[model samples]
Target: MASSRCTQKYAVGSPASSKASPLPSFHRFLTKVIQMNQLHTPKASRNQETGRLSFMAPVSPPRSGEAARGGLSRRNARRVKQSAPAFISSPCTFPTVLALKKIAFTVTSAALLSTFVVSPASAVDKDASANRPKPPAGMSRVGGELLGRTGTQVKLGVGAPVLPKDLTGRSWIVADAENGEVLAAHNPHWRLPPASTLKMLFADTVMPGLQPKTQTYTVQEKDLADLGEGSSLVGVKEHLSYTVHDLWLGVFLRSGNDAVHVLSSMYGGIPKTVADMQAHAEELQALDTKVVSPDGYDAPDQVSSAYDLTLFARSGLQKADFREYCSTAEADFPGAKKKNGKRETFKIQNTNRLLTGADGVDPYKGIAGVKNGYTTHAGNTFTGVAERNGKVLLVTVMNPSSKEPHAVYKEAADLLDWGFAASGKVTPVGELVPPRSASTGTGTGKGPAAAREEDKGKNGPSHNTEAVAAEGDGGGGGGVGIALGIAGGVLALLAGGVFLVNRRWPLPDLVRRLPRR
Candidate 1:
């Protein structure tokens, strides 16, 4: 038979004539071979004169030799059994080579596409790692390892109720106040603004030094000078003398920044009060807190975590005065002196809605007291201590996203309910670790014992009703730190792989083409 003619033209002496023309011929031959193999065309389909194959005709039964061999004829079987080198070099073998090339192209494209798809995820991971908050210097995780984790942490037993799904707080923790067993938590270590809740630490630290009934502070213009705009105040008048008891009432009942400032001044000054609060926090092992303002006013870097706030609540409640002040729903604040040389007083109610049950909010049963706080930056934060059936639970909720009035109190109430129900039914996720001095033998001169003694001297014997429990010294160690490092390393590797893939196949145009939200 005459060989088929090549009708296609290529430029003379061009690279296409030497290389490109053969590719098309090879491709066409492979395509036809593939069609023939798939269709299994009958022998009648081949033209006897040209010896050319056609695949559109009907298939035929295998010949006797092909049937014996299961598929191929004897001649074709011999060709298949030939050595690899000869088969590869033969023109009839181009189909196998083309098939392999197609597979290689497909695999390579798929791998490239996979890298492209994964690069954005890697970049996002790297960015998250870069932006993740670092723990305070030399500050260990006071709570257990589970508290260090980012999402919800819980260990339910056979009959424990699930945590409330409607909880929208950025960070929260429910724990036993007496035993310091953390029942459950969500983002417990996330450090955010604490608003006025930091006052628990402030009051815990400085309240011991000043005798509430014996000491009196005369409010000065400078005492209230640094008050933040729109600060809650208990109506402290300049040049009026207020007993330390009255100032604390203002702090707890009204969340009064003016009262906080005057007390801070009496505690030395705002700077000294802040420093003392920081030192007290470290002693309590509230490692996630950074106290910039004594009144928990929104200041730069003034942050605390749910875990730390719970620590504050637990520690503050151990003191008789702190407990009495926080639990007090309403109290009389000294007002301007009456004309008859008598000082009248105005009523100030506790800002903690769960305690006061004012403003249409139902009072949480068994509610004792801790504190609630709010600021534009901190949103709403609360830490409540409640007792039920001899089981006291401490719940701290921070930055709940709901805009409803008193949402923080509602969430705290819900968590408290869940905690009470789950008590003894769920295994503790972590422990509210003891103060630094409590673990170590060293005396910080500001330990719980010293605070207790100070409380005894100031508040007398009968007021010291609750005893501070001894906490175990178990440390969370370097587990969380190591996990963070590993995460960063994994993100780094992903970022590097993405960089290499982008170097080989640039994706700037493709990335730019992505539709904006």
Candidate 2:
């Protein structure tokens, strides 16, 4: 009955035809049917505003075949009103962008995200938030368990060194840098303060933009003024200009927040530097990191996981300048000149105990360079890389037991030993999950873009992808990455639902009023 009424001639019989899209007009016709069933259709109730009829207001229901009182028609206007699409007046035009309805849910989701703020996108109101996916019993996403868990045993073969209990740090990862495979790990994705070790990520992002020995910046009082309290300084004096190389040395050897700010000011600002670092982190698939500060001071929400720290080191090591500065145990720090116009000089020692052989810690065999960190909240964090017999290994130790400050390096040393020995045997128990790629579909577990990026590095040899998690391993398999994948899928679906609502109920303020089962 409704189909016949809708198809029957309307404009052909009485009303003047128009050029407005038929879809919008049909929407109004449906609205009148719904309104007629709910309220009394009043007589000739034309809306003074909009110069159109107000079909929503009290209106008298059609009597048998009588014309519903309104303008723009001669006979009962029933045929045109009911068939062509009943309207208080002309139909409102819907934007062409709404054509996204025919696209894939993923495509629609991307569009809706731009159109709706949280208020407009309030598909999940507080009342129905319970329907949202909840973590397993007794589990919470604050641990990032929805995405993945950090602490898990991994082994490549029957006798591989996938030990986590032996490591004292709260999080650690030992990966074969030559092959882009995680040999072993413990809570590698557990978010923890990185202290200065995050400088690796800073350098990785900003170093590309800087011209090392050529890009010089004068140190200003404002540059050194905002150093985090009790944070390390590279002895950068006010009014002294330093080259990019020198400031990086300050970052690598002294873990200088002062040097970071000076360089950050050179690059942009701390905020922009942090944003770039975060963007680079996303690019590197360092999912377990959030950069709130360039120097990795114990700022709220500033965090990095062992897995992410390893990724930072791996990426940073690609540049010759980064490797050189990190490997340099001692360097000349240019100081503020005397009134007599003589330049003063001071030596800044590398804080990495293993690399510099400092504080009774024996240097790990074949140790090259990376970074280390310490703070009240972070305790101690260290990222290290070593090459022996042409095999390069990377290890990251974060927030070691506070009782022993040197334990962080000690933990890294132990992992380095195991990584080299177990390199041939272990598979990645937990993977370094890549960031979302545009080309990857919702179902694909990984993206080719990520694979291509990791396979190539800045001025470095291509990392071997053979020993990756793709092959079978004897390590304790980790399903955390899979869990996070599932959670991510749920979010995509929720976003798709938003666009569907926009398409189905194009009218304002009508979504909430629809009946529910």
Candidate 3:
């Protein structure tokens, strides 16, 4: 015999584009069940070949004319879209199989979801959480005890596959900049070499100190000594003069260590610059950061943590010039002269893959900047910020576990995707504590927005270009999580997905599927 009713097929769409998309479909199935009057009976039947119910529905009696007249209203009918009963008036009449089915479904889904949640929120049952991988002793990934106390911690989803895919970073944090909340993190306090990710802190400390961008400095031959072997350079030449403004560009866009040395020497010396940076870190309450070199080349006893790196980014983003330099995809870099009184110039590309979108990476929509770093010791580390719908998020990943160079950026993108999707939907797991308090003294820090009109006019477009393309968007949905409620039980599922697409060209598919960071 052939059954007459069954739920249609479900083809999952991209999670990011659809909002509460799955709920309606799942609900439709339940509506059929609750509305049953039991006057009509289910005819047990099977597909001729498959040997299964063609439509395994429990046929119910049609709504009585008197009952329909007694209850449904035009307004209520409109609200339900005529798809389901307005209320479950006969709970006792519901078949026992419904209960059995609901329980079985919940159990099956929970078992499947458990395989994915390796680092669930602390509130989850201990038996379910027992197998979770905790960081080794002395390692501090996602502070378990702190989460319960701070109440600022968040899990991306109940069971969303939104965890940074292919993440190899041993320590990382995703934070909401506007709320100053840590959405998700692991080993936040673990010490590691920061490589160039520390540059944001250096910039936050030094950019203001070099007040006169117009002031020119002739590079000293001795400044070249600061360049470490096997390190990145911005092609600075001894005896060539570079304005404080242009050198800052080199420091940001190219991750130029040589430019950092020149700036460090101008401030005082490497030793003084390092001391100032450390002092600034203390003021910011970035206790995990110890600055031995202003340029962040590997050195004995020099270290920083994911938490401190995010603090540095949060503080630095307040200055508009810092935003401008970091987001610039490409800009003209003036090179040394050949004695003809004319300077050569070439485009210096930002090494930050999140901004440039080259190197098999997708340019993060709304991505501005913070910094990225790599060294033999530090591996690849990145601290990044992105904005959407007025909510800005920061992601800092230190020392990717993958050997690939782009893994850090890719993992950083994944974390950012998860952060944006998790915003508002999940409660924070930890708080990004603000600086204890700043007592007013003669303040050296002047954010770019506060700079005089005359200064900005004099500096001009040749020095800085408009941001590539950051635009406004609407806020994301709230109360969303990986674990969805199926009736009274939990159905663990991915709540959001990778949303970015290359609007410009043929390689859009290549970008979406790119395995690199």
Candidate 4:
């Protein structure tokens, strides 16, 4: 019944001829039917009715701003309204059948074209990060675990697996001159005599700045006067002259105390030189270490921990020239000619047993030129770099007893073996609490009472609430807080996207308000 009424309301009719002009009223009714059909017929039949209207008379101009109100403000609405036959149709009474078919095809083609148009270009970033190489085995083991534990909420991955309990003794640490993250430490805070290993720091202060070939120093009366010295010495006579480079070879290779004093005095007066050594130590942030003598001699105040000694040795080895000097097993300082001066020649030997194959350390097998030091106070200290299968490991041992220097080596080997077994992998937890802005607060884990005392004492930076829980607090508020923050950030972003979609297109009301014509 509704369809019948629609057809009557939007009538379709044949055109009246001039021969029928005698019935002008009938002709008028026929004309009105054609106009109604042109205005209100279904879109599929409108083209034919449009042709009849065009043949009968000219088209009227559309109302100003009517098109804007009808649809163009919205993309989908504009598509529906623009394609309506009244908007673009040309009237032709004969061949209306063909026009209707053409209009149907045009509408179908427009919809399909919209679906198949090329999609917008998406942003694509090349992942150059994957090309980076893995860190060394020792790094994989130590820094991996520590960084993983601290930054796990970021979800990087778990750190290369390591037995943390196995990492307890033997004095371990993870330090980088770059980041300064001492990821793991054992007995790092303790101070002990550094023994001969202290020479590495002595070499660090001297080697880089020396014009080795040009600078020459004469052995002072006091420097060479002490004969039959129990400590390491490069025997030289009083008033004997040597180049700075030659003295460096002796101090580095033979662990020569005799040559160390000569270099120290030549670089600056003894007092100023010793101050520089202390200053260098401060620069490296090796606080527990104090150097009373340039050589790693047994002075009452000269002390360093295993960690600090490693830090000192690391600084020296980082220099290409320093490593060349220390790595040399033997060197011959040229003898003075009789015409030039009295002939004085000496063969300096490397003291590091690991390189010499002494005390069961075999460099051929693995160990590299690192210094060894021993004193009554410091039993035996060793630091060296070992390379195997493209993996380099740095090991430092402090005060292993005379009977147990090899045992320290064995333990280092074990760490290397275990470290390589775990590939370079680490998981970083996101910030437990967002890193407090330095502008707002210091992240010191101190309480208010402690902070007040620090402020009053004028010792250093004050303690603050930002201090995180102590290391090894397996389950703490910091850990829980970090996990929750990451989850919250992800959820919030998802909700925002959904809200934007709903705001852009509210469709249900538009469909319900479509008016019946």
Which number leads on TM-score?
Answer: 1
User: TM-score of predicted model 3?
Assistant: 0.57
Query: Predictions ranked by lDDT, top down?
Result: 1, 3, 2, 4
The lDDT of each candidate is 0.61, 0.56, 0.57, 0.44
Model 2 agreement with the true structure over 219-304: per-residue lDDT tens digits: 77877777766556777878877888888888887777788899999888888998999998877667558899888877898887
Compared to the true structure, candidate 1 yields what TM-score? 0.60
Each model's backbone clash number: 0, 12, 21, 16
Error of 3 at 246 (Å): 0.7
lDDT of 4 at 311: 54
User: After superposition, which runs of candidate 2 have C-alpha atoms over 4 Å from their true positions?
Assistant: 1-147, 156-165, 430-517
After TM-score superposition, what is the CA distance of residue 418 in candidate 3 from its true location, in Å? 1.0
Give the range of the ten consecutive residues with the poorest summed lDDT in model 4. 45-54
Q: Single out the weakest 10-residue window by summed lDDT for candidate 1.
A: 480-489
Better of 1 and 3 by lDDT: 1
What TM-score does each of the candidates earn?
Answer: 0.60, 0.57, 0.57, 0.49
| lDDT (tens digit, per residue) of candidate 4 on 1-517 | 3223322332222232212222235335445543443343222100111111111110111122211111111223214222334533455443555443433434433342332222111100011122212211121111112222211111112444442232322243332222122323333434667767788888777666676545787777876543223566665446778888888877766666777777776777556667887887665545557888777767788887655666566556545566567666667864555776667675656665555554445543344566766554554566765445544445566543212335444444454454444324322211111111211122122222221221122222211111132233222111211111111112211332221101111122222322221
- Candidates 3 and 4, the one with greater TM-score: 3
lDDT per residue (tens digit) for residues 1-517 in model 3: 0001111211112122222324345445434432331212111110011111122111111222321111122222222112233343444333444433433443333332332232222222232234323332332222222321111123434443345445657678887764456676666766778888889989988988897888999999998785767556777889999998889888887788889999998888888899999998876667668899888888888898888898788767656566666666667778867589899997777777787776567788777777887765666678988766656788998765453447778788888887777676554555554443532122222212221112222211210101111111101111111111111111111243211111121122223332234
Better of 1 and 4 by lDDT: 1
How many steric clashes does model 3 contain? 21
RMSD to the hidden true structure, all candidates: 27.0, 26.2, 24.2, 34.5
